[model samples]
Structure formats: structure tokens, C-alpha cells
Target: MKFFDVFLKQFRLQWRQYLVASLASYGSLCTGMSMGWTSPVLPQLRGPNSPLPEQPTLQQESWIGSLLVLGGLIGPFITVPLSKHVGRRWLIMGSNVPLLLGWLLAGVTTNLPTLYVARLAWGCATAMQFATVPIYIGEIAEDKIRGALSAFFLLFINIGFLLAYAIGPFTSYWGLTACGGIISLLYLPFSWYLPETPFFLVFKGRLEEASSVLQQLRGKTKDEVQPELDSLQAMIAREYEEEPKISDLWASRGSVKALGICVFLAMLLQLSGIDVLLFYMEELLAKVGTKISPSDGTIIMGVVQVATSCVTPMVVDRLGRKLLMWTTSLGLTIFLTLIGVYALLDNYYKYDVTSVTFLPLLCLIVYMILFTLGVGPVPWILVAEMFPLKTKCLASGICSFMCWLAGFIWTRFFRDVAASYGIYTAFWILAVCCGIGFIFSVALLPETKGKTFDEIQDLLNNRTKQGNPGA
Candidate 1:
């Protein structure tokens, strides 16, 4: 078949699956809005753009930026258990409802408490995104294309952030938020049409439905899909035979190892200081003597981030996950070190580096480029791919919770750290963490590049002792 026809053929039956994943990503887009809104909106609030009775104090401004993490703290508890019971589609639907409400609320509300509630709502939605959307996409995707599709989740998120960065400056705060609500509305139909994963259907003893879904998603006949159905039945039978308890997640060596990898990656993700770079782009740029205006710097940063992230979906399956992880982590370590060295000389030693004013911008651009290449998207993909079916939801939820916890702690304290110790200190800290992450990830992260769900779990569980396939 011609490549174009082959591509069309792939989508003919699996279009709905792809559509659902795309739809689910709008939640991430809204998340981008939540992330980018604060940068522009904070300046407005400090002035007289909205109905805020007065300019916010520095403490309040910090809270406004970090308060979303507070909502992240609560989302998984509500959706983790709920997703297992109700369904990924509805949970996704339910998650976005709050996003819509939060954006709408932020668009209109004048009260500080109400504004705080809106941030919390956005946080809750973001947490749920990390918990559920990836699981849905992972379960539905064929292993060959799964990496690319998984990258879509991050792609939309960056797009959302870019939208806010690009448009937030030009529009009113209310108008920017209204755009967020519209994205939620656009996603609803796609979510409405999404099918439950065949794995979930089979586990529920809906064998016929599972068969039908497999046929549809695989673009194959019922006869062709029966073997897959039978495999699910066998897997389900084994799962029921030896169901894992929540308390015993760590009892199994493989489970513990898998969870460790997930959590470690999560910590590495935030510790890289992307959040600080993004959240404090304006302040950091001005302090670093970047030649560009802060607002333009932020927009440029957002654009670079989005552009670089686009490479992943194309190269992920082809180049594989491990390469991206270690290379990018090491790359981040190097760039961050450059940034730290520059800032240290410029800030503490009173060295006039004005001639190299563009150095910080060069380092930041490289930092984001390296970040989007792997560390930004791979951890979430790993979370979705590594866990056994029995513990998938629970493991993903817990890891997401911890990831956000890291986010919360960093977002809340990084400013203080920068204020007291200097941004150089923060940069150096991030460099050390990224360096360690590069080492650990290279040493420990198992490759899941082209494995089916069964194959991935089996590799993790040590069932098919090919003596370490990734190595």
C-alpha cells in the first residue's frame, strides 16, 4: 500500500480511538491556559485591569501562581478510585467540567476567595489529567504508535501554554479565560464518543464488547481479533486468581521497581526547574540581562517549548524512550550549569557580562529544547506503560500525586530560594538534580519502545526473562 493510503487505512477503524485521545488532550490544553494565565494576569491584577479592589501583595501574587498545586493535592483521591468504578471517559468528562467552571469563574470573579477557588479547580483538573488521560491512551493504542500518541498529551499541553503566552498579552484576562472554557466545550464531544478500553471491558467480563472494540480499534475482522480477546480473558482470569492488594503494591519486587522508576522520573521532571523557568520567566529574564523584553522572552520561550516538544511525537517510537530520557536529562544538566555559571558571575561577583547579554537567552532556549525532547513527556508515558493492569490506576494516581506534591513544594518555595540565595543557586540546584536524573535514568529506566501492553507488563514483571531486553 502507498504510505498515504496506509495512513488513511490505519485511521479508518481507529479514528474514534484517535479522536478520543485528541479530545482528552483538550484538558491538557486548558491546563496550559491555567499555567500561562497567571504570568499575564498577575501583572493585570497588580494594576487595575480587573475588578480586584486593590493590587495584590507579593505574598498573594506568589499564592496565585502556586495555588493550583493545592487543588492537585485533592484530585487523584477523587478520580483514582472513581475512574476504576465509573470509567475513564466519564472521569475525563467530569474532570474537564471543573476546568470549564474554573476558567469561567476566573473570567468573571472579583473576590479573592473566589479566585482562589478557581485556581484550585484548575489544579484538580490538571491532577486528573495526569491520572486518567494517559491510562486511557495507553490502553487503547497499539505499541508501535503508542509513543507518538502519548506525546500528543504533552503536545496539547504545550500548545495550550503557548496559546496563553501568545494571546494572553493581547487579550483581557477575562477573554483569555473565556478561550479556556471554549477548549473544554470543544473536547466534550470527543470524550462523549470514546470507547472503554478492551482491557477494561474484558476485565469486567464483557468479552463480546471487548472483542468488538478490539476489532474496531485494530481494523481487523472478528476472527483476527478473537486471539486478542482470548489473551485478555486469560489475563483477566489470572488477575482474578491473584488480585493485588493496595497495601501490597510494594511487596512484589517488580512492582516496587516499576513504581520507583515512575516516582523518580516524576521528581526529576519538576526538579529540572521547568516550572520556575516558566512561572518566573519575566523576572528571571530581566534579572539575567536577557536582551529581549520579558514579555517577548516569555512568548519566545513558550514558542520554543512547543516547537521542540513537537519533535517527540515524530521521533519517539523511532528513536525510543531511553535515548530521549538520558540524553535530554544530561543536556539539561549542561545548559542549566551554563545558566548558573553565568548568573553567578553576573549576580554575586559583580562581573559585567553585558556584552554576553544573549548568553542567558541562548541557554534558556537550549534548556527548553532539551527538556521537550524527552523529560517533559516520557515520565508520563512511562507511568502509563510500566504498571500491571491490576495496579495501573492506583500506581498512576499515586505517582501523579507525588509529582504534584513535588510541584507544589517547588512552586511554593523556589521564589524564596531565588530571593534569598540568588537565581544562580536555584540554577545550580536544578543542574545537579538533572545530572543525577540523567545517571539514574540511564542506569535504570527500562525501554518500552515497541512492546504491546502484555509484553510491557511481562518485561516489567520479569516473566519473559530475555535477560533484560532493553539492555
Candidate 2:
């Protein structure tokens, strides 16, 4: 009842903000579909009903999954410069081009190389959406609701995952691709109606237009929004004074420290086995030897992910970032280690673990829940929160690149490693990564739940003393 009351109050206060943020995050939904496509499609491609003339080799299969990450590598580069020139809104709208093309090409392709090309195209759009959506949402939302709105990005992505998992096994290859295309088409039309973010407008010296947009976003009159409009102007001025060049990212000890934190978190996010789970969830379920079929298991996992993703938006500001990371990272470490132990005993020792078949699925569900609550959503939120406006694009791009690069390496090699050693080895490695993440949280992670950009910068620059992280 209390949660609902708070939600209603926020909705009454910022309905327009909610509406706009939701629309921007729809791009994340498309990326989720793109990311989830490989899981169900891989089995079909490698099986007897392949769309291609020949089945992909194991190497080609790895490429098919990692190529999207490769394409994402270019997305930040495209977004960084273009976002300033064209604005985040147009950049997001423009991404539909590659998105539609990728899905259409994948739907129609008849050969392996063409399919790879199509995945790469989809990957490009995926990264573009991810890079821009959080920034757009972050800029438009009020500080009180910013964390919640930012969580919407990942929530929609999980929703997309659920859509793909639920629909892909039942649909034809072309049918699945058509669904993706239609999603992109729907996004294009609705996104045209989205207002340009006031922050960007102010940055471009359109203060009056920025004020008007803020009026709509805040549901306030010119007088009501003037203070915030003035704040935006001042923030932009400070940014301009700082000369937001890429070099500015390293110009101060604080800036360098913030970059290191963002980079480390980004790496931790991918290294925690998210890509492996996203790309090969069905396969992993098969290895688990659960009572449920892999398709059903994947869909169930997706549902859990979507549901758990809802929790962060509700409680992130209340609970704070570091607490969620610490709690979830510890949970993930334990759950992943448990899964590893299961795989070790069952696969290596060849135990008759039929009675405990439920263990793997149970751990996986909990893992999905914990991940969506923290690891899946928090890093992206920090990406938007940690940097100032001038260096945001550069910093975001670098972090996004680092993120996908790690994902590509891990995802590309996961199969080889699992085959060479055991699947238990893979799970254990991810467990170790999660453990390190927990340590990182305890030792160095900073809190930014409700802080303004100035306060955040101050904390990072050490202009303000925060409680000792180790203590």
C-alpha cells in the first residue's frame, strides 16, 4: 500500500516524464530481442531445419553470437560525436534503420555469411540504443525518480527477452524476424512524438525551448520550471567552461578515478556471465539436465528476469546503489558457486543426481532474480550518473566499448572453454568474478542514489569527504 502510494504520487507528479522515458526505453526492448534471438535460433540453425545451405561450424556459431558484440563496438563511436551534433532523440530514432535492416536481412538471408552480416547490423543498433537510452532518460527525469526511470531501460530489455523466449520456439524463422521488424516499426512512429530532452536543448543554447520542454516534462508552468531550467543552464555553463573534450576525462584525479570505477563496473557486468547466459541459456539448461525442456526453462528464466527487474525501479533510491550491488553480488557468488558444485558433482563425478535435478533450475531462477535486481541494471544507471554532461558521451562510449569487448571475448570463448574443461569450470569462473565484484563493492564503490551531478562530481573528485568505503 505504501509502495503504491508513492508510485501514484510520482505518477501524478511526473506522468509526462514517465511516458517519455518509457518510449526511449523501447529501444532497449529491441536490443533485448536481438540479444535473445541467438539462444532459440542457434539450436534451429545447427539442427536439421537450418535456413542456411550448410550448418555453421562451432567456430561460426561463436562468431554468430560474438559478432553482435563486435558490431556494438562501433556503436559508442557513432553515438559519441553524433549525439552532440544531432541530439539523443534523433540518434535514437536513426537506430531503427539498422535495427529494421538487420532483422529484415536475417529473415531473408539464405547463407551463413549473410546471416553473420545481419547479426552485426543488429548488434550496431543494440549498442546505439543502449548508449543513448540511459542518457536520454537520465537527462529528462527528476532526481527523485531518475533511478526508477533508468531501471525501466533494463526492465524493457528483459521484457524483450521474455518476448523472444516465449515466441521464438513456436515461430518460424521468418515469423520471428518479422516480429522484430514490426517492433522497430512501432518504435519509429511513436518515438517521433517524443520531446527533445531539455538538457540537450539547453546545451544547444535553446533555453526558451528547453523551458517549454521542461514544462511538458514536469507538468509545470514556465514559472514552476524556471528554477530547474536555470539549473540546467548553470550545469551546461559549468560543463562548457570545463571544455568537455575527451582529454577532460583524465584532466583531474577525480575524473580519472570516476572513469576507472565506471570501467571496472562495466567489465564486472559482462564478466559476471550475463552474455553467456543471454547467448546460451537454453544450452546451459540442457546441460543442467532439468526436468523441464530447455525452451521452457529459457522462457521461465526470461519471465523471472522481467519480474525481478521491476524491483530495482521501486527501491533503488530507497536502498541505494552500493547496498544493492553488495547484496546481489554476494547472492550471485553463492548461487553461481552452488551451480558450479552441482555441475562438478553431476558431470565430473558422474553422480546420479536425478532426485536433485531441481537444484540447477532453482539456483538459476534466484541468479536471474538477483542479477536483474542489481548487476543487470545498476551499472547502466551508474554510467548515466557518474560523469558530467561534457564528458558523458566520451565516458559512456568508452564504458560501452569496454563492456561489449569483454562480453565478446567471454561469449566467444565460453563454448571452447566449457568443451575443453567442464561446464563446471565455466560456472566456477563466473562465480569468482561475482566474488570479486562483491569485494569491489565493499572496498571502493561509491553511492549516488539521490545525488545531483555536482554532488556526484564532488564525491568522485574528493572535494567532499564520504565515509570510508572499507569501513
Give the C-alpha miss distance for residue 81 in model 2, angstroms: 1.4
For model 1, the local distance difference test gives: 0.81
Global lDDT for candidate 2?
A: 0.88
Deviation from native of the Cα of residue 357 in model 2, angstroms? 0.5
Colliding residue pairs in candidate 1:
none
**Candidate 2 local lDDT, residue 11:** 84
Off by over 4 Å in 1: 1-17, 461-471
Q: Give the alpha carbon lDDT tens digit for every residue of 100-189 in model 2.
A: 889888988999878888888988998888789888999999998898999999999999889889888998777787888888788888
Query: Which regions in candidate 2 have their CA more than 4 angstroms from the true location?
Result: 467-471
Among all candidates shown, the one with the greatest TM-score: 2
C-alpha local distance difference test of each model = 0.81, 0.88
List of clashing residue pairs for candidate 2: none
Predicted candidate 1 versus true structure: per-residue lDDT over 1-471, tens digit per residue: 475475567657567666657877777887877877787777778666775888888778778778887788788897777865787777888886778878877878888888988988898988888888888888888777788778889888888878888877788878888887887777677667778888888877788888888887787989998987887788778766775578656867778888999998987888888777776677788877677888888899889988887777767776778888999999999989989889889888989898898999989999988888789889999988888777888888888888888887888888788889998888888999999999997788778888776776677777875333233
Backbone clash tally for model 2?
0
Error of 1 at 274 (Å): 2.0
